[model samples]
Target: MNTLQRRNAIKDELQNQKLISAKKLALKYGVSRQTIVGDIALLRAQGQPIISTVSGYKYQEAGTAYHGVVVCQHTIEQTREELEAIISLGGEVVDVLIDHSVYGQIVGTLGLANQADINDFMSRVKNVNHNLLASLTNGIHLHNISCSDEKVFNSIQQRLDDLHFLYHD
Candidate 1:
């Protein structure tokens, strides 16, 4: 297939699938992984709501009602507990961000909405040589979380506070 055709197929795949990996897409399309990455970048430039996560790419839909940013601090060992607290309280962990002394701001899309997503993310972190972005800044980071309403968002904050995951001055 042509480049345009392959990109179109990739966009369709994003809409149809929950998560897609660049490696898997390259294998399916008979292209290099770098090519798939470029295609995704082009698609994003053209206004696709594609988000890259640890698991894979996700096509974000506008069904969410409320979004809020939370500051959190915890050890690497407490990552799973923090995530569970947020997810169990009906918050979708949209992404994590940290300000680096050199790189400025770094962000990682999470899109973790359920226990399964959390499990996959945790497993990927444990099994791969990948390090959490928060690790760069001494376990302090920001999370953009989404929920159905402000009530749920507040509840998430409270739960995080209860768990001592919320950062405070």
Candidate 2:
């Protein structure tokens, strides 16, 4: 198949599967990993809601859940507690966003849907050079979290507030 066909196929695979690695895509399509990377770039340029996570590339799904952005301030040490609080309360931590003087709005996808995801994130933060966006903004950041219902959202808000992590403006 050609580049167009391969790209279309990649789009389909992403839509159908929760996550697929570039390596797996390359093997399936008989192309180099770089080819798959270019295909993903073109697909994203065409407006596909594809997000690359530590696990793999997947399509982000929007459902009936209520989504809200909560402002928070905390040290890097509190990252695990903050993430656990949200996930334990039935909220999916979608992303962390911060306003940078130079870059304007910057976002880092947590995609922390479960305990394992959060653990992996914290692990990478410790082992890699990935800087937390909050570091650039003096420990103030925002989390885009999704909840199944209003009650869950309220619980998350209350917990974060109690932890003194919620930024009040």
Candidate 3:
């Protein structure tokens, strides 16, 4: 198949399966690993929201089911407190999002599910001097939180508001 055909096929497979690997694509298309990489690059350049995780590549289609971003501003200490509160409410803190003057949007996923997880996370952050992606923003960050349902979402939002962590505009 041609490069375009191979690229389209790979994208279609990823859309159906949710994950794909470079080796698999290379084998299926009988192309070099470099070719596969180029194809993936082309697909990405065309605006496919393909995320490369440790597992493999995942396509996040528009309107796909997931939690939304909640922009919040707080002091660094308040940021830590707010994160702990959200996890306590049984919501997963998916990521910390920030906007950089030069780099546009920056997001770092923090998959902490409980207090122990939070402790480990905070420990890592401290060890790194809290210099992670959003840490550069000095507590002004966005959290992409996920809960089982809207009730849980509302509850978490209310708690954030109570703590004066939610940013209202």
Candidate 4:
């Protein structure tokens, strides 16, 4: 009804579901999309554990997840294989990082936790016609992966090695 009520409702809606788009929430709240975006920003400032993904925003649970950085070099054609090896072993590829000589570090937030997420991400990459960060460095990049245990991390490393994607450096 009011701004506070609408904000609270938006929070409740996000809590009760997996994800919701700002446009959809704006339509439901009879407000502009920018208004909903502002509400989300304010809610985040107030410390909501909301993560914005391509599909929408979702509440994320903080847990004792094991995180490790996997450095690899691969062609654009092997992108799916690299992501699949990590995701299949219960690793969520949080982000991709590339170090450049002049510009320093460039990062891309992937948030890829499953095969479906990987698929969607790759599709968007194709649709957008953006270059993969690795291309800038001739296929060398690092992926920060979060998993449930060291075992999964090891498996991911071994799988990447088997795929010949693991960069020695």
Best by TM-score: 1
Residues 1-169, candidate 4: write the lDDT tens digits.
9999998999999999977889899899899999999999999999998877766777875673789998999999899889988988888888899999989999887778888888888998899998899999999999988888898889989999999999996
- Give per-model CA RMSD: 1.3, 1.9, 5.8, 2.1
Least lDDT summed over 10 consecutive residues: which range in candidate 4?
A: 55-64
Clashes of each: 0, 0, 0, 0
Give the TM-score (vs. native) of candidate 3.
0.59
Pull out the clashing pairs in model 4: none
* C-alpha TM-scores of all predictions: 0.94, 0.88, 0.59, 0.86
Number of the top candidate by lDDT?
Answer: 1
Residue lDDT tens for model 1, 1-169: 9999999999999999989899999999999999999999999999999999877888996888999999999999999999999999899999999999999999888889999999999998998868999999999999999999999999999999998999997
- Flag the better candidate by TM-score, 3 or 4: 4
Q: lDDT score of model 2?
A: 0.88
- Candidate 1 regions exceeding 4 Å error are none
Lowest summed lDDT across 10 adjacent residues in model 2 is found at 55-64
* Local accuracy of candidate 3 as per-residue lDDT tens digits, 58-84: 675454244756778787656569878
